[model samples]
Target: MSLVSAVQVRCPSCNTPFTAQMHRAIDATKEPRLKELLIQGRFNLAQCPQCGVQSALSAPFIYHDASKSLFYCFMPMNMGGSAIQQQQQIGQLTNQFVSSLPPEERKGYMLQPKLYLTMQSLIDDILAADGITKEHIEAIKQRAALLQDIAQSQSVEELERKVKESQDKIDDLFFQTLDDYIAQAQEENDLETAQGLSALRDEISLLTRPEGEIAQQAKQLAAEREEMLDKVINERDQERLRTLISEGRPLMDYSFFLALADRIETAQASGNEIEARRLTKLRDTVLAMIDEQDEAARQSLMQAAEFLRTVIREQNPEQYLRENADRIDDAFFAVLNANIIEAQRRKDENAMKALAAIGTVAASILEEKAPPEVRLLNRVMRTEPEQRRALLQEERALLDDRFVALVDQMISQLPEENADLAGELRQLRDMAIDVRAQG
Candidate 1:
């Protein structure tokens, strides 16, 4: 079963309200296509019909790969809460995920899921599990950053200087990144940026006509790009085409489109007008999809910014938060966290304190909304390590079946790495059982 829900969103651009479907959990084994989206960094993406803007919601979700015995609970670090509160939230999500599984398939690893504080780290580990090395991933990241720097050069001279200085760093990944962005720019009708990137590519190609190992990798990348283009050309299903565009986004660059246009021309010259028309239609559809994704990315960022502005402008941010608590979701926290980090970078103490206050309030609200048992568990966990026993004893009246069951479930699934927490949960469960026996 797909774990998705309809979320109401107000477009930051047009202020038009709409419903967006978001997935709460991903079972990659069942939905391999979704796994592709996650890998392509397009999962949980939403587009506004009103303004045609796409937004990537930074929502909390669980990822399970039964094949690899991988289970991860990703709670955005920006969700702002104490360690105890965060654990309680994670516990709830973990329990829900476990309950969703069939009894036979449910394993001990499912219960003690690995916790990821950030989406990128989670993605990196997922790739690592798939045999992608950290060093390779880091190199790709550096190349991407370098590409951005080259693109942002204020003048031709500056761009040329940067290109020459970073010639050694440029490789297949760098060209792939450049090609991807150029394709995006063309899709969005930013001809200037597209042309600029094309010119930069020409210069880089001349400087490093790669040979041997580098040349072999470049040839492989080109072949993969051609394969992706063929998939788009032959796909008959609209949905599948969309998926292809998303999964092969990196390959859908200037060269891919050029190759596609060449095919269309060849079909037309060969008097295969029907084939030519079909290819043209495919091109149009791809362009539209790219535009929608670009808009979504823009709008999502704008929504986060607008939400932050609203919170910061209010005299009573907490009260505002209380009234509009639904808006303080993962995406909101992501934006807030980024701002807090930027403020810290700038050494703006006041801004950090203000942002931190909002986080504290958000945590408090989350704790307040938790089930009574969960709230009690949070309190117990929050109590001083040495004094928790006394606290639990004093509040023994609260130790009912629900509390005992929760404790037991936690103890059963607790990872060996978390020996301290496992011991604490065991103590709680034992004391709760003893209290019930006495009655």
Candidate 2:
């Protein structure tokens, strides 16, 4: 797709104006993101800030898949033009696109460009490039459509019924749809929607699985350890699980091996050689499942440490931190905090200053996002008389009884020579009274 500039878009839900970045032509061979977005059916999805609503931009775009030896122009029907009418435009775009390719890379198929009037048709064509048959695509689409019905169901009974009837539809597409929404909500900091969708995903999981399978699996493990099954599988915190540690309970992950270790000890202590042998085999089976995850976590921490150092050296620490805030979870902080401790231990002044800048950025973001009234009040209380007057004038919406009273008290206590401050407070008081009266 051509690199289209940002355009102003009004949110349909809230009527709030926002800027949307859109492209009219996409070349997958050049920009991988365009391919990924088209595949996910989110090429032109514009998310609104005022209300968490996603809307698609109606625009013509060309999809160039060099890998598939295909170039198709998707001209939106809403533009009041058929594919034939836009062939010249598409031809020019295709010509420009192919000219940029190397001689060996050019092929004959690229000469005869395909045309699709609808976005959906273009997406289906793209999916076909992967060797997926039409029947498979339709089948997946059928399942994908059921997700809306499932979302609309009012009660758990209705959801459960839909889930039971549409078992065939609960495939990869269904899960992927939920996963994309979850990811979008998290990226946007829409925690309520993210949490709601997460709970729905859990419910869907419970519904789709065979009845009593969860219960049966729970029964397979030890009874006390039974409560810890969800904790381990879901990576949930199980604070009281009995494990290898004598002082405190272990994490769900370490607890599995620790519990197994405990079981081995008990078997030896009780002289149950046969049971101990079986338990060791079971422990080995469990170990196989968790080994990869443990290794990955260790590797991720090392990568995070290196990344933190790189950020300090080569990037704006605040900008990097802000852009990657979501990725900086507990593990990231653990790595960062460890470095801070090392810096302190070694009395490394420059290193400490650099690390401290990271903390300052986080603090500034938190301060900027504080509630409007709280921030206004703090500024009003601390600023000089002239500054306070300007602050009051700027924050007319925050001029309430408490604020007015505070300003009035300040005016009464100010020195006689402070006529400007007192005059400003009186004017503010009048504005507050007017606002309250209207309210």
Candidate 3:
């Protein structure tokens, strides 16, 4: 069960008081989405409605994973509770959690809960349980640190010096780390940093080119280019040829241009001047098409960003959210996220903050405006077990037998592999019945 309760909390930004849902216990076997959010570091994220301030809610939380048999209690070091008191609280919480599970489901591991001094340690352990070693994670972190250092370098001499010292570490992981930083910088609206990292990426790519494979690889590439073009033009394989224009299909690869150049040569060699001219014209058209597409995408992203900026810059952003409730979804978030990164790259702090605020405000409105069924279901899931009976009875008008039957039918349709959902549905049905009885 997910142990959560509503709380009155003041926004850190504008000191605005608001009602927010706070989770005490997250169960992987019950509310899987919470578990996913936890892994994504988005669990307990709250946004202030008045000021649009978004931040993670730092508090004690019990994280339970049945499959991994990992039941850990995370107590934020800032809590400042006595060790003995914290231990007692953990013991009591552990007892309550174990009792909530069926006897058959309760394992010996529940007898003693593992205590993490910090949230980071808890996250590290969770990743470790999934077979990701701490060393590998650390190495990736080092790469990220180095990437930032390179991006923040004052001059090419400094960058070159640093590269000389850490050249061996500039592998795939290093570039990936650099890319991640670029995205992060964009999200924060740090433009200068993004551009700097991008430049560093290109510099590294050039510096790290294989010292001796160029000539041989060039010949190999030329052969591949001619062969592919032979299939596309001579064999007239339209399907194969169409791949060149496909999005993210490496349209900018040197071999792709080589293939077009080859087509021109072949046409001229065959003494077909018209055909040679046509191929040359086609290459120009393809280049133009690529440029046009790139420019169009950039404009679209900027447009979306500007719209978000307008919404956030408003005195009452909630009005905008209410107006465009349907548009504030995953795709919208994605566009906003990309623009945020771009904003950060541009060193646009105001835009970054505005983007963040827009997300928080939009999310709050969307949640508040969710369908009655979704709202009721979430309430039922987050409510205390003891209070659930009364809640169901109170909401019995909406949660009629038809609703229970629908959920019951939903459970029946699940495959045997989805045993967790089946158990959760059963629990929901029983709770609804119990609540209906209270009425």
Candidate 4:
């Protein structure tokens, strides 16, 4: 676990004083996600509740990756201190990290940590250790610059010409890089920049991909969805409708309700009074069903949260997790992740470690029980893009229609807020389909 503590910081936008959590040390082996957040420049970032302003707190921190034998300390130059004072701060951080480890785990390398004056330089070295060299990063930057030029095109002809000229540069990594920029902008509360980047991403996606292919596919999917919804809404059999509602619960989102309302309006506009009345009744029934489902989900999450608290109190969650394996469902994991995020928000190192341990155990259990195709899909999702093809090749037997359908199901079940994940799943789904077809 990392060392976390409370600190007071005033928001740059609103100048509102608020307590922010800061991490002084990070053990990459124990908390890999923290390392990722660090690389993304999101580490120790604080967001103001008053104005939604986000700023990274400039503080001294240590990073350690045991597997890589990589240890580095970061001390911001902005924090004015004498050379001796900086050394003392770094020494204290190093001591804390080394003392937290077991005697056997402590090595000579742990005693001497490399120091960095800036976070960006530290992040670059970290990426280099992960095999992402400076050239690769520079290439991504060039693509970003090209994307900016494309976005600033004076006319449709210029945009098209620029895109065609830089077709070689506009690869999957291009969109990914742009998405990173959008995420950074959004985090900093620069909505205009974020929105612009998003629009540019969409435009680039349309230009680089098969023309009208995505739109056509989306249209077909929507039509099929509409037909299914119509069938469910028009079904007069109470028993059949109940079964349909239960099965189609995932599709009963705000959009689904809005579509139903539109149908009711259309019926009224067409002077179909009886049909309108019937549609209204169906809408009411569906709304009630959704409310009931929401309540059940809320209750389930509450129970899961309480169960996690109990496990944390026990301090030995292995037994509890094993005994209550059946209860360690998606809801439980969702609660677990939420708890970890909240702990991260408050910089509660102990809570984060405990929740992470529980999550690891629960995930292993689930993986053990999952089908081979599911296991392969999980690995594919976790693997880097360039390496996934080889992984799929090794597990080609699992790349069947069933796996593709499973991916589709996941994509469909994801909430609208998880657009990024859904997009990734869609790409994975396409890749799996391609692999299966390669047979």
Best by lDDT: 4
Instruction: Please give the RMSD of candidate 3 to the true structure.
Output: 19.5
In candidate 2, position 416 carries an lDDT of 76
Lowest lDDT block of 10, candidate 4: 183-192
What's every prediction's RMSD, in angstroms?
25.1, 24.0, 19.5, 11.9
Poorly placed runs, candidate 1 (over 4 Å) = 12-14, 30-42, 50-56, 78-105, 152-161, 176-203, 210-439
User: Candidate 4 residues 1-439, lDDT tens each?
Assistant: 5888999999999999999999999888778668868976679999998998999899998898888998899989998889999899889989987887888878798777899998889999998998999999888779878877888998767877898799899997888777667655543335457656776676677677776896785576568668768888768897788778877775565567778889989999999999999888888887787677666766776677778778778756888888788888887887677567656644558767878988999898788789988888888888998999888888888887789889999999997899999998888888777887898
In model 4, what lDDT does residue 87 have?
92
Against the hidden true structure, what lDDT does model 2 obtain? 0.68
**Residue 348 in model 4: lDDT:** 55
For TM-score, the strongest prediction is 4
Worst 10 residues of 3 by lDDT: 242-251
TM-score of candidate 3 to 2 decimals: 0.40
Q: Output the better candidate (1/2) by TM-score.
A: 2
Per-model TM against the reference: 0.39, 0.47, 0.40, 0.54
- Clash pairs, candidate 1, are 53-295, 53-296, 54-295, 54-296, 54-297, 55-296
Pairs that collide in candidate 4 are none
**CA shift of 31, model 4, Å:** 3.1
Candidate that beats the other on TM-score, 2 or 3, i.e. the better one: 2
Which segments of model 2 are wrong by more than 4 Å? 10-17, 30-32, 51-53, 81-85, 99-109, 171-195, 210-212, 216-439
Candidate 2 lDDT tens digits, 36-59 = 678768887898988979999987
